[model samples]
Target: MHSFESDTTPNRQEKEHPGLKLALELGPLLVFFFANLRGEWLVSKFPVLATLGGPLLVATGLFMAATVISLIVSKIVFKHLPVMPFVSGIVVVIFGGLSIWLQDETFIKMKPTIVNTLFGVTLLIGLMFGKSLLGYVFNAAFQLTPEGWQKLTLRWGLFFLFLAVLNEVVWRNFSDATWVNFKVWGTMPITIAFTLAQMPLIMKHSIEQDTSGKP
Candidate 1:
């Protein structure tokens, strides 16, 4: 087993500015959002965009391109691909490609549900095997006791499943614009709130408690 000291810090090659990391992660989503919102105008300007089907389809294509670009940029900047984004990127490319090639929006709409479920199941399965895979995703952010890691992993796994269900609920019953709005606006705030809610647990289990009182 790796020590807490070794598990907390990211490897040398994976180190990067937090802002850059945030940008790379969100850039593709932002591209998808803008492309969908401005699809008609862009289609008018480009003229060739109409051949892609519609606003949502155009957005899907651009979203795929942007996702791939962000992953490449991440590799160039950090010298390695981060696990979560890389997985998400792969899904975006596959689903987005299908959406465009087949001229169907359903695949693009279902991407989040699929990605979230994949993460949820993977984490839960890892826990069943006595492994806390969340550490791989958030190791750079916090160093906690084994108990904390287990608890956090379980919470995130369940939370991911909740998001998958939520995506299904939103996209299935709502219009495309509503779904897009919720995807761009709703999920982000909910995730931020969930992360903030975990701070108490993080503080309580922090490894610093073990060393803070040393003389």
Candidate 2:
């Protein structure tokens, strides 16, 4: 009983709930940030948490849990998992698990590098194959011409690789707190600025849809 439009277009709730969606996506990172900041206090209250290794390790475990919870909440609310978050969550769990299992911080520290590189390479490869894989992430928000998608995807792919290299340089040289701070605070602002910088391109190639949903 569903038309192609109904099947393809985002549901009303998904389109209207940007704030909730943002919260769901960022909630895990915020949890990781605060958990690292107050990790010792948490351990003092619940001595059992000490078994996780240390502050950073405990933060890693909590971050993994929070990511799983966020994905679950997203699925329940939106009836689908957002692609980027899902992919990021999978990498977090893998790296976090390795960090905790081996009592090695290196794995968790390299998580950003791995995830960003994965995304960057995947996007670039998709483009090489004449696909704009970024469409899956933004298709709900607006429609873009094929050229727009290609340009946007190329920019994002390179930006992601830049972030990967940046992550490597920071975590390799900085203290744990400094790296965590950069991860939570620095990266968000940089990404937001980069996204804002892309507005002109988006505006230039955006396809207008009519009230009846025809473009």
Candidate 3:
């Protein structure tokens, strides 16, 4: 559970609350999904919610708010920003603003697809160059054997691509509200399950502690 509070520095580190970390990451997403689902009722009860116009708009605003809340909580409780979430927050703010000002929900929806696809492409490309970018992202959190990193990196790269394809399918076919729900709830469960399913490989391939005591 302490992984939530874990320090992200290369030199200094702290324990984190894993459950709390997952909660913070997923909580805002659920908010956006539900908000989109019941957007009409929300707008009716609180007219302010309607200022954003329809479900997509409401979801965007809620998404932004939830992102901020998650960031603040992570800062206060964990005392540092989680690397991935920090990067994601920046993207959300930029894309969310574009969605609002442009009055196009497509921009916000594209956020995930773009981000995921970029990650996918970046990892695959990096691999071609014989570089392991996932090492940079998760090295601080978990110490894995070299083989472990390679396997994990490959899996994540493919997963990101899968998400991109899934996003395209969802948004292209479904309504805005449905797409938002899918983006949040749908992605979370799939990602977590995917992550958990990797535990065996991670455990099996993980590095033994370095004699020098550094990963």
TM, every model: 0.87, 0.88, 0.81
Better of 1 and 3 by TM-score: 1
Preferred candidate (TM-score higher): 2 or 3: 2
Question: Which of the two candidates, 1 or 2, achieves a greater lDDT against the reference?
Answer: 2
Please report, in order, the local distance difference test score of every candidate based on alpha carbons: 0.86, 0.89, 0.80
Instruction: Estimate candidate 1's alpha-carbon lDDT, on a 0 to 1 scale.
Output: 0.86
Name the candidate that leads on lDDT. Answer: 2
TM-score computed on alpha carbons, candidate 3: 0.81
Residue range 94-177, candidate 2, lDDT tens digits:
999999999999999999999999999999999999999888778767899999999999999999999999999999999999
RMSD of each: 4.1, 3.6, 4.1
Question: Considering only N, C-alpha and C atoms within 3 Å, which residue pairs clash in candidate 2?
Answer: none
Q: How high a TM-score does candidate 2 get? A: 0.88
Residue range with the least summed lDDT across 10 consecutive positions in model 2 = 1-10
Q: Residues 78-145, candidate 1: write the lDDT tens digits.
A: 66676677778888889888898999999999999999999999999999999999887676666888
| Model 1 stretches with alpha carbons more than 4 Å out | 1-19, 209-215
Global local distance difference test of model 3: 0.80
- What C-alpha lDDT, on a 0 to 100 scale, does residue 144 get in candidate 1? 87
lDDT of 3 by residue, 1-215 (tens): 33332333432322357677777878878887888888888888899877787787888898899999999987777667876677678788899888988888888888888888888888988888888788887776678877788888899999999999999999989887678768766888898799899999888987765579665
